[model samples]
Structure formats: C-alpha cells, structure tokens
Target: MKKISIQGIKGSFHEDAARKYFGEDVEIVECRTFRKVCELLDRDEVDGAVMAIENSIAGSLLANYALLQDFHLHVVGEIYLHIQMNLMVYPGVKFEDIQEIHSHPIALRQCSEYIDQHFGEIELQEKSDTAGAAQELAREKYKDVAAIGNQRSAEIYGLEVLERGVETNKKNYTRFFVLSKHNNPIAGTNKASISFQCGHYYGALAKVLTIFGDNKINLTKIQSIPIVGKPNEYSFHVDLEYDTEDNYERAIHLVLKNVSSLAIMGEYKKGDIELNKP
Candidate 1:
C-alpha cells in the first residue's frame, strides 16, 4: 500500500482529500501542519503529500503556495472536495445550552453568520484544526462547548452533530493538490505553472502578460506573493493552460526573455469537477 502524507490528523480535510484521491486502502501519514506535509515529501517519508491549495469561499491558500516553491515538489494531481461544516457537541448536549464554541479560525469565520444569528453570546475559541477541536471537546466531555468541524470528525470523536452545514454558503468546497517527488509523465503536456519576479520597471507586468495575449495562450490564475527576505518585493505565480506545441514554447520563451526571474514550477494534468454528488 502506498503511504500518503497529509497535513493535520486523521479527521482533517487534508486526510479526506488524501482518501478521496488515493483511496482508503492507502496508508496515511499525518503531519501537524502544511510545512510538515512538504517536509515529509522532501524526506521521502511518504510517497506523496496532499496540501490544500484553495477554498471556494476563503480564496487561495498562500502558505501552501510558498511550500510548493520551497519544497520543489511537483503537482502530480488535484482533488476538489465539497466541504460540509457541522457544529458538534457531546451526546445529550443541547445547542441552546452551549455557551462556548471552538474550531479552526477559518471555519469560525466561514460560519460567522450562523453564530451571529443563533449564538451571538457564545465564546469562540480558535484551535489548530476543526477536527482537533472536536477531538479535544470529546476527550474533555465538555457539554457546554461545541466544535465546528466536519461530520466525519463528529463520528471519529464520538460527538453528536448539533447542526450540519453551518457554513454561510452551501457551495463551500476546497481544492487540494497532490504533490510528489516524481512528476506524472501522463499529466497535461499543455499545462504549466510558473513563478517569476519582474524587474522594478514601469509596465513590466503588462509586458509579460501581453506576451500570453499575443500568443493566444490562456492564463488561468495569477497571484502575487511576497518574496521572503526582500521587503515589498513580490513574485507572481501563474497557471497557464495551452497546447505544448511549438506555439506554446514560443510564447513561454517570449515571456522569459522579458521577465527578471522565471521558473516553471510544474506542468501536470488538470482535472476540474464539481464534487459531492450523491
């Protein structure tokens, strides 16, 4: 069985993504944080790592992107998981009786509306992970404290689901990337992910983007992240999907000639889907 490394414990969304992509039969190695997930991959402790890349509601995971650059791991696959945030409590505990809630900061923010409307006075505590919060509450048998996590977490921690789908948006989903030391040979030859730093010159970004327009290559996502150790200096990460023919190569070459520093992070298969059906 292939061993997969994921950030957070068994009940985390990262683990769910791993199981969804690699199947339950695969062995799982849990890491405490996103950086450790990449470290496990770098140290060859596991075959690959699953890292959350973006959320439909919360926007891009900037920290994971930094890990991608620091680790030099290739993006071998992608998975989109529909998130179902739930409020969990100990058995026999009533929602009206709860006075405190705990969960990951992101989960709390996502369900701010529900909390404000129904439990405005509830004291919110931020934990490392949502599932971890549930596990903590379960261990302590806290009847007055609830946890905002997934239903799976409630089951794993032997907690009751006080409320399901507590997120403000019904279409909540998170995009995770499967990273491996080896790149998938069968991945999309047409797709490319690149990072570049532009010289501090007027119209530098415009010139770089115009090359893609002129060559008719589509730019899917563009994000700017700060370059560590350099105050106010940022690098642009871009995802480009285009045919890997001579035309695409020519376009890339044109952009490289003008950019200060350009590095192809990885080019792998692109799988887009709306998850959680049935």
Candidate 2:
C-alpha cells in the first residue's frame, strides 16, 4: 500500500482528497502542518503528499507555495474536493443544547453566515484542526460543545451531525496538489505548473504571457510572490493547460527565452472540478 502524507489527522479534508485522488486503499500519514507534509516527502517518510493549495473562498495558501519551492517537490496530481462543512455534536445532543462551537479558522469563516443567522451568540473557538475539535468533543463527551467539520469526521469520531452543509456557499471547493520527490506522469498529459522570475522591465511579464497565447496554451492561473531576501523582485507561478503537447512544448520553449529563473514544476493532466461525487 502506498503511504501518503496529509496536513491533518484522519477524517480531515486532506485525507478525503488523498483518498479521492490516490484511491481509498492508500495509507495516510497525518502531519500537524503543511510544511511537515513537505518534510515527510523530503525525508522519504511517505510516497507522496496531498496538500490544499487553494480554496474557492479563502484564496491561495501562499506559504505552501513557498514550501514547495524550498523543498523541491514536484506536483504530480491534483484533486478538487467539495468541502461540505457540518455541525456535529455528541450523540443525542440536540441543537438547542449547544453552548459553544469549535472548528478551524477557515471552516469558521466559511460558515460565518450560517452561524450568524442561527447561533450568533454561541462562543466560537478556533482549533488547529477541524476534525480534531470533533474528536475532542466526542472523546470528552461534551454535550454542550459542537464542532464544525465534515461527515467523515462525524463518523470517525462517533459524533452526530446536527447540521449539514453549513457553509455559506453550496459550491465550496478546495484544490489540492499531490506532491512527491519525482514527477509521476499520467497518460495524456497536457497541463503544467511552472514558476519563473521575469526581468523587472516593461513588458517582460507580458512577453511571456503573449508567448503562451501565440503557442495556443491556455493560462489557467497566475500568481506573484515576493522573492525572499530580494526586495521588490517577485517570482511568478502559473498553471497552463493545452489541447496538444506540441503547443505546450512550444510555449515553454518561448517562455524560457524571456524569464530569468524558470522551473517546470509539473507536467500532468488537469483535474476538473466537475467529477462525479463518490
């Protein structure tokens, strides 16, 4: 069985993403932080790591991007998890009996509208992990404390879900990146993630982007992050998808001519958000 590292314990969203991308039979090595996932991959503690890179509502995980660069890990695959936050409590604990609510900061923010409309006065506490809060409440037999997590957490922790889909938006999604020591290429590869530093001159960034258009590569996402220890200079990370491998190769060939530091982070198939629910 292949072992994969994740940012949170069992029943967390990262585990769900891992199972979804790598199959349900894979072993999960839970880590306390995202950087720990990188360390596990670097130290050969696991075969690969599943990490949340971006959320529809919360935006990008900037520090994780830096970790990928620092660790020299390759993005091998991607998973789009539909994050369905829930309100779970100990068995037989009714909704009205709840006195306090706990969850990770991101989960709390995602369900802010629901909490404000129903239980605004409830004392909200942010925990390090969403499923950890549920596990704690169940283990302690806290009848008055509720946790906001996922259905998997409720089942794993022996808690009862009092409310389902507590998120403000029904279309909540998080993009997870599968990282490893080396690239694991799948058949029909057409998408890629690349990072580079462009000359800090007029049209340098535009020239690289124009090359993609000229070569028929579709730019999916682009982000700029500050280069540590170098003020005012930034590195650009981009995700590009192409219909043909030839077009992608031509674009990268042209792109490298215009950038100072270029790295092909990964070349893999694009994962769509519309996959059927399991």
Candidate 3:
C-alpha cells in the first residue's frame, strides 16, 4: 500500500482529498502540520502528500505555496474537496451541556457565522488540527467540550455529531495539491501549474498573460509569492488549462521569452468542481 501523508488526521479534509485523488486503498500517513507532509514527501518517508493549497472562502494558503517551492516538491495532481464542518461530541451528550468548542483556526473561521449565531457563548479554542481536537476530546472524555470536525472523525472516535454542514458557505471547497518527488503526468492532462520569476521591467507579467490568452490557454488562477532574501521580487504561480497540448506548449514557449525562470509545477487532469448538498 502507498503511504501518502496529509496535514491532518484520517478524518480531516486532507485525508479525504488524499483518498479521493489517490484512492481509498492508499495508506494514510497523518501529519500534524502541512509542512511536515512536504518534509515527509521530500525525505521519502511517504510516497506523496495531500497539501491544502487554498480554500474558496478563506483564500490561498501562502505559507503552503512557499513550502512546496522550498521543499522542491512537484504537484503530481490536484484534488477539490467539499468542506463540511460539523459539531460533534461524546455520545449521549446534550448540546446544551457543551460550553467549549475547539478546532483548527481555519475550521473556526469557516464556521464563524454559525458559531456566532448558535454557539454565541461557547468558548472557542484553536487546536493544531480539527480531527485532533475530536480525538483529544474522546481520549480525555470531555463531555463538556465539543469539536468542529468531519463525520468521519465522529465515526472513528465514537462520538456523536451534534450539527452538520456548519460552515458559513455551502459552496465552500478546498483545493489540495498532490505533491510528489516526481512530476508524473497522466493521460488527458489538460491543466498545468507553472511558476515563473519576472523581471522588474514594465509589462513583464502582462506580456505573459497576453501569451496565455493568445494561445487559447485559460489562466484559472495565479498567485504571487515573495522570493526569499530578495526584496521587492516575487514569483508568480499560475494554473493554466488548455484544450490541446500544442496550445500549452506554445504558451510556455512564449512565456519563457519574457520571464527569467519558468518552472512547470505539474501537468495533470483538472479536478471536478464539488459543492455540498443542501
């Protein structure tokens, strides 16, 4: 079985995306932090890792992007997971008895609206991971404490789900990058993630954006990360989708002429857009 590391415990969204992108059969190596996932993959402790790159509501995780480049890991694939944050507790524990709730900071932010409205007086605590919070609650047998996690956490930890789909946005989804030591491209790979460094010259980035448009390549997303130890210099990471390999190649050819460095992060099939059901 393949051991793929993830930023959170088995019941976390990272695990879900890992299983979705790789398969349910793959061995899940849980890591407490996203950086640990990248480190493990780089050191060959695991075959790959599912790293959350961005969320629809909270936006991009800039630190994770830096970790990818710093660790020199490649994006072998991508996964989109529909986020559903639920409040869970010990079995038979009444919701009224819950006075404190804890979860990852992102999870808390995602469900801020629900927390304020329903759990107004609840003491919110931030933990290292969402599922870890539930696992801790179960292990410590804290009946007064609750957790915001996935249903899998409740099932695995033998807890009861008090509330479901508590996230502020029903359309909330997180984009995860399947990182590996190698750039393994698959058939029907219509999407590519590339990072480039542009000169301070005028229109440097604009010129490349034009190249993408002229070549019929869709620039789905772009992020600018600061280059370490280099002031005022930034590296641009972009995701491009093309109808044909020829167009992708042509765009890269033109883009290379305008940038100091161009690295093709990966060429993989685009993930399907998933939304939580009402």
Candidate 4:
C-alpha cells in the first residue's frame, strides 16, 4: 500500500483528500505539523503528502506557501474538499452543558459566526489539529467540552455529533496539493503552477503577464510573496491553464526570457469543485 503523510490523523480533512486522490487503502502517516509532512516526503519516508494550499473561506495558508518554496517539492495533483465543520461532544453531553470549544484555529475561524451566536462568552481553545482535538475530547471523556470537527472524526473517535454544518459558510472549500519530492509529469495536464521573480524596472511584471495572454494562456490565480531577506523585493506565483500544451510551452519559454528567475512547480490536471452534503 502507498503511504502518504498528512498534517493530521485519519479523520482529518487532509486524510480525506489523500484518500480521495490515492484511494481508501493508502497508508496514512500522521504528522503534528505541515512542515513535518513536507519533511517526511523530502526524506523519502513516504510516497507523497496531502497539504492544504488555500481555502475559499479562510484564504491562503501563507506559511504553507513558504514551505512549498523552501522544500522544492513538486505538485503531482490537487484536490478540493468541501469543509463541513461539525459540533461534537461526548455522548449524553447536552448543548447547555458545553462551556468550552476546541479545534484548529483555521477551523475555528471558519465557524466563527456560528460559534459566537450560540456559545457567546465561551472559551475557544486552538488545537494543532481538529481530529486531534476530537480524539483528545473522547479519550478524556470531557463532559463539559465540545469539539468542532467532521462527521468522520465523530465516528472514528466515538463522539456524538451535536450539530452538523456549523461552518459560517455553507460553500466552504479547501484546495490541497498532492506533493511529491520529484517531478512526475502526467498526461492531459491543462493547468500548471510556476514561480518567478521580476526585475525592478518598470512594467517588468506586466511584460511577463502579457506573454501568457498573447499565447492564449489563462491565469487562474496569482500571488505575490516577499523574498526572504530582500526588503521590498517579491516573487510571483501563478496558476496557468491552457487548452494546448504547445501554447503553454510557448508562453513558458517567453516567460523564462522575461523573468529574472523561473521555476515550474507543477503541471497537473485541474481539480473539480467538490461538495460534501450535510
């Protein structure tokens, strides 16, 4: 069985995306941090890793972007997971009995509206992972505490879900990158992610973007990341989609000539937007 590293235990959304891409039988190696997930992959301790790149509700994970650039990992594929945050508790714990809620900070932010409306003035503790919090709650059997997690976590940890779809937005979605140490190109790739640095001269960035437009390449996303130790200097990371590989190659060749430095991070098929019913 293929082993993949993830940022949380079996029931976390990372696992769900890994299984969705690698199948249910794939072995999961849980890590407490996203850096560890990349480390395990870099060291060849696992075949790949499922790492979250961005979320529709919570915005991009900036730290994770640095990890991607630092580790020099390649994105083999991608997955979109519909986030359905739930309120879970120990069996027989009533809603009124709950005084504290615990979960990952991102998960907490996603459900901020729901939490404030129902549990005003309650304590909110940030845990490393959502499933870990739920697991701890079940292991300790905390009667006065509730956890915000997913339904799969409730089932795996033997906790009762007190409420479903507690996320402030019903359409919450997270985008994950299936990363590998080496570049393994796949056929029928309509999307590509690349990073490049532009000169300080006028219109240097605009010139590079025009190359893609002239070549019929579509830019889906673009982000500016500050260069480490270089005050006021930045690098651009962009996702491009092209109908033909030839057009993509042409645009890339032209972009390479224009940018100060360029790296092709990944070329993979785009993922569909997925939703999990509550």
- Which candidate number has the best TM-score? 2
Local distance difference test, candidate 4: 0.91
| lDDT tens readout by residue for model 1, 45-132 | 8998888988888899887888888888888777889988898999999978799999999999999999999998679999999889
Give the alpha carbon lDDT tens digit for every residue of 34-134 in model 3: 78888899889998888989988888988888898888888878888898889999888898898999899989988899999987867899998888999
The parts of candidate 1 lying over 4 Å away from their true place are 228-233, 243-247, 273-278
Error of 3 at 181 (Å): 0.9
Off by over 4 Å in 3: 228-232, 276-278
Per-residue lDDT tens digits for candidate 4, residues 201-270, read: 8898899999999999999989998888987677988999999999999899888898889988899999
Candidate ranking under lDDT, highest first, comes to: 4, 2, 3, 1
Task: Quote the RMSD, in angstroms, for model 2.
Answer: 1.5
lDDT of 2 by residue, 106-151 (tens): 8998899999999977899999999899889988999899999999
Candidate 1 TM-score, C-alpha based: 0.89
Ten-residue region with minimum lDDT total, candidate 1: 183-192
Model number with the top lDDT: 4
lDDT of each: 0.85, 0.89, 0.87, 0.91
Provide TM-scores for the models.
0.89, 0.96, 0.94, 0.95
In order, how many clashes per candidate? 0, 0, 0, 0
